[model samples]
Target: MTPHHGFTPFFTGDSYISPASKPDWLASALPTLTFYPKAIGVVWRASRQASSGRYDSRHWCESSLNIVRSLETVGCRLRVTGIEQLRKIDRPCIFIGNHMSTLETFVLPSLIMPWVEDLTFVVKRSLTEYPVFGHVMRSRNPVVVDRVNPREDLKTVMNEGGKRLAEGYSLVIFPQHTRTVQFDPTQFNSIGIKLALKNNVPVIPLALLTWAWSPGQLHKDYGPIIPSRTIHFAFGEPLHVSGRGTAEHQQIIDFIQGNLDNWHRQDSD
Candidate 1:
């Protein structure tokens, strides 16, 4: 299938796209053929409910649990441990996790929504342009940052995150700042720690093993879902910011790397 604009065609081969056929036909039909209706429905319903001001944090928590359960029914399993660590915390925290896939975007909200009354994420400004998802994101009041201007973006994060924390909302941040095919220690950043330090909130290190389930493939005929492909969500002990600056940041990064390494090693064994 040839790519047109920002979307890929539904079918491949010369027969499908002839001189007589127009690109608009394929673009219009692709959304239905790819099951976008159902996807959009799910996103819309969840987002609408989450954005509704009538619901309290407890209500959101229950809704998130149901959402995760629904996702699992479709072969997406979330094996979560270290949940007890979060249960012991009495205050708001800045959750730091490695970015790997879109899985966490859906999963993390459900996992932590129940425990924390207010939960918001730091997302790229570009995502705000997406159709239904964008509407939901904005309604949910997430902190959107423009990566191009580092100075303005950092200022926005610190100012917005501090306000959210003060209001009892826990912030979930992808410290790597972007998704990658693989996790590398070198790519990790200390921005999350810096936010925690600035806001005087404890940092909770989260290690997610979620790249295994490749979602929304180009073709449905790719193959059956990979069985025994585990997705782990682990929460590490909270790290409190100390007088140490660079050392503290490095320690947080090392802590996340160590946890991910151990999780992978055990999975391999």
Candidate 2:
């Protein structure tokens, strides 16, 4: 379903899957060309809107939806499920997801903001410092962390994240320090769970596979776009954190890991 400022916030179902695509001629890019130019163009345009003070939440989401459509135009299929969970909640919440690539970071706003109010992310400080993209991100008022100092980053998230929740903003946090194709529980932290517990909000597990935009070698994030892989996002029901949140945190981990394992298995079959 196409998302717009005035349309129904959530699609008709708990899921919305992009229809399978036939081979597309546009999917063929020049062998020497990469995805950066196309992505930068989108970001650059959004940055201008933001700088001019014309970028609001609706505009922010629209830009993301544009990115989704742009990817589809190039032959990437999106399979989104459990999106109904976003609308089922009545209060502010925390979202914990496994970080895969830059795609999830850019794509989630459109999917989430329609159902929930004041959606924001806990991003690495560098993201808020990028050239054109940084302007777009800063306008959203995300919780930023330096990522170099664990104690400081924790303090930043807990303090800043707490304030945002108090103001009715939902937080999306990727506990992994860096984007990776493989899921590692040891690397995923309970920071989101802790923040939820502190603010007495629910933590929703967001499991996504965005390897279509793989992590780059030289730039780390400027990488190849693999249209052959289907991008997937699964939103689990919200879990309230209590009693140290041990069980809830584990449930979040299990949810993400289970979906990823199932998706990989299906691809193999």
Candidate 3:
């Protein structure tokens, strides 16, 4: 049975063989099992029982906070500063962050939800096909794009993201395009800045220190909870588009790099 959104059997049963399956293989293969599949069916049924209301910003905030609490139990600590700057701004803005680990996907909502009532994100279309996460992501109405078609995808981003901004919801975009083992300036793109300019929203640069939580380790344990490695997040003052021209492009690149430099400096000190 193919795993459907909100329904997967991995968390439900004793049939989860450990040594028989490799971790990476299991993560990729478990969703494809159809014969005598118990977990997928269970998840599908449970998802049906869940509430069908439209995405509630309040619920999103609460769920994110709970995730943070749970991560703390495993030795993950998040140190966030400059959040007050966000509160002073009155309009919806585009939040562009450097992609590092999966931790930011789980923690960022909690940090920004309190200041802004509405929030959504730009996600790869493949994520919409994930088991349980896929359902939750879809319900949130994220801007999903097919990355294979760059021309079409950017058009969709501008249209969908613009609508969300007009609705008073802010968007979080990872301009690095993909998660990297280490930061590479060459991999960065200006699409995020284009989106912000298109929507006429201020661009807020964010730096994520997610290396604190080592992902894809052999140990499946939750890891440490207290005195955990400190993760830092710095929010730069918003950059507003001055005009549609060459200067706009340079400003966007400078905004991202400058904030990253400041964040590293702060980390060193």
Best candidate (score: lDDT): 2
Global Cα RMSD, each model: 13.5, 2.4, 11.6
Instruction: For residues 1-269, write the lDDT of model 3, one tens digit per residue.
Output: 22222222121221111122222443234311321133234335333433365445555555555555544433345566666556655678888777876667766876776666468889888777876656666766789887787788888888998888898888998866677636666776667788777777888877666665454445321222222245667676777865662455455456556755665686678
Q: Please, what is the whole-model Cα lDDT of each candidate in the order they appear?
A: 0.63, 0.84, 0.61
In candidate 1, what are the lDDT values of residues 80-189, reduced to their tens digit?
66665666566788888887666577667656665555688888886677765666667556788987777787788889988888988889888675676467777776
Preferred candidate (lDDT higher): 1 or 3: 1
Model 2 poorest ten-residue lDDT run: 26-35
lDDT of 2 by residue, 59-166 (tens): 878778888877776777888999878777777888899999989988998888876667899999889988888899899999999889999999999999999999
Cα miss at 66, model 1 (Å)?
Answer: 3.8
Please give the ranking of all candidate structures by TM-score, highest first, separated by commas.
Answer: 2, 1, 3
What TM-score fits each model?
0.74, 0.94, 0.71
